[model samples]
Target: MMITSRNTAKAALFLILTFFSAASLWLLLEAEFLAITLILIYVGAVMVLFMFVIKMLDTDQSTLRAQFTRYLPLGIFVSIIVIAQIVLVLNAGQFDIAMTGIPEKHDASYSNITAIAEQLYTLYVYPFELAAILLLIAIIAAITLVHRNESRSKKQNISEQINVQAKDRMRIVSIKPKSAKESK
Candidate 1:
């Protein structure tokens, strides 16, 4: 259904519906929190973001159709590579439920969020910090890439910016008051 949709809005609607279905499945599995989180994150936030991005794109159907054939070969190659990886992984028995050990049932007093937080903050602290630093570096690199040097920039000068006064931007002309008889 999503693949055949030519309209971006329709595609987004399909994606939102898919998220809703997955959330419903999570609820059926008795993970109320997971279902709610899925709905809130994907349907509420991500779907709205997708809509905003699609609207901002401001693309015409003709332009999209024109590029479709141009990238078709690359898309097909990527799809084939993805399918091959899936087949290899499936054949490797990594995802076999029978081979995997049964999960231990949690005690009624145990909180899922607390356990996750403990693992993340204690056991995985270094790795977590490394990931954070990597993300920070990525952000800085992106900023650097977008930051034009003073020579390339046409922005206003800081000196000029600070020295500006309201009087410079606005002119208040003084005029003598005229009587109604003089005006006539």
Candidate 2:
């Protein structure tokens, strides 16, 4: 029992450390775009999502039962198939394994940011703009929808809004001058 618990803790720690290490490796690869995306989208967002789900389900490593009877064989089979496929693909590919620091032209001349912008604006302008518009519309719709409640008065009348006038908020004040009283 003690050994199993220790193993569980070790496994959990290993999983967490591996997740962080993988992200760090991505950062070291000089692929800033991919690394930041992995950290921001995967590590930050998905980790939080998983934590929420774990809390919601009241599941911890200790309490969870490992039901390997039904799924173990299937999992092993699938994993082996995936590994074999990956191995075959990697080994069969004619990818250039040359460790030449960077392509001669690119290392000295390629301005990645400028090139990316040019490609994005010239090649993917319409789609990028459309996506931006869609995101904007979604954000506006979400903000509009999130505030909807009967607690707020029912639907507003556009006519009532349009009909509003200065008189509605006006106040009349008399400008009377003070008269001096005569002493008898």
Candidate 3:
């Protein structure tokens, strides 16, 4: 019933290997942004969260493979199917994606990130702006949900809040000296 450091180290190693595999896939797909995000978000945030939860639970053992006994045969079957599909895909040759390495010549128009950005804003502007709006909403919602009011401040009703004007908070009463000076 005790957790061992060896199991923890193994888990850490497995997570790192998974992250690297995913990052390698992103690179193969020519998606630089996705590869970087995978490393940053998965390796950085999710792995850190995993370690924190594990440490908090003081786990000496994991129930990952042991708890899912009923699904093991199905899992193996599905994994075999997936591996077969991947093999088929790798062996199929439909797309001509290679450049035959012949001497090439072209106008020098593809020099910098600016050119790519300009094309993206013009050609893919709608999706780009939509993504920005989505990200903005996500950020705002995250901020709103995270900052809960845990303080024990007195709660006021809506009518009370609306009725309380500036006069309730402050008052400027006429002084007795001003009245006496007027009489004199």
Candidate 4:
């Protein structure tokens, strides 16, 4: 649905559905933490961001619909091929428990989150830190790209403000007061 949707908002909605489905699969695998994280990160934060971007873009729906119609046949063909491949792989009988053994159950004290953190901070720490730095740079680049310095917009000059004197902004006007309306 997401691939076929012409409307960006609809596509985002479909993506949210996909995220939820993935979270559901995680739950089926008894990975509650992963399921919640997926929902919170992808569905909550990312989907909201996507929706805001879609609204801000205000894309021409007519053009999107036209393009969708143009490439729909190709999309359908690719989708069919993908589905066929998945079916063939599933029917290959290599995924049975006999072939892939049963998963070992951990003790009651075992914590997947702790184990994941250990692995992440141990084996993958450098890559994780690199990814964080890259994300930070990307965020800074995005902010810089969107920061417009328009001449018409007011901007504070700290140096000028600090150097300004009261006299520069204020003037005293002298006016003679009337003597009780000339003693009227």
Identify the leading candidate in terms of lDDT: 4
What are the per-residue Cα lDDT tens digits for candidate 1 across 63-101?
A: 999999999999999999999999998999977878886
Candidate 4 lDDT, 1-184, residue by residue in tens: 9978877788899999999999998776666779999999999999899898888996986777678788989999999999999999988999888898876776678777887788899999999999999999999999877676666667799999999999999998998887997968
- What would the TM-scores of all predictions be? 0.66, 0.48, 0.46, 0.65
Please give the ranking of all candidate structures by TM-score, highest first, separated by commas: 1, 4, 2, 3
Estimate the overall C-alpha local distance difference test score of candidate 2: 0.67
Superposing all C-alpha atoms, what RMSD in Å does each candidate have to the true structure? 4.9, 10.8, 10.9, 4.6
Q: What lDDT would candidate 3 get against the real structure? A: 0.72
Q: Write the per-residue lDDT of candidate 2 for residues 114-180, one digit (tens) a residue.
A: 7668888999999999999999999999988978775866778899889999888787888776656
| Model 1: colliding residue pairs | none
Relative to the true structure, candidate 4 reaches a TM of 0.65
Clashing pairs in 2: none
Off by over 4 Å in 4: 1-10, 73-99, 147-174, 177-184
* lDDT ranking, best first: 4, 1, 3, 2
> Taking the tens digit of each residue's C-alpha lDDT, what string does model 3 give over 90-121?
67764335633433443456333465578789
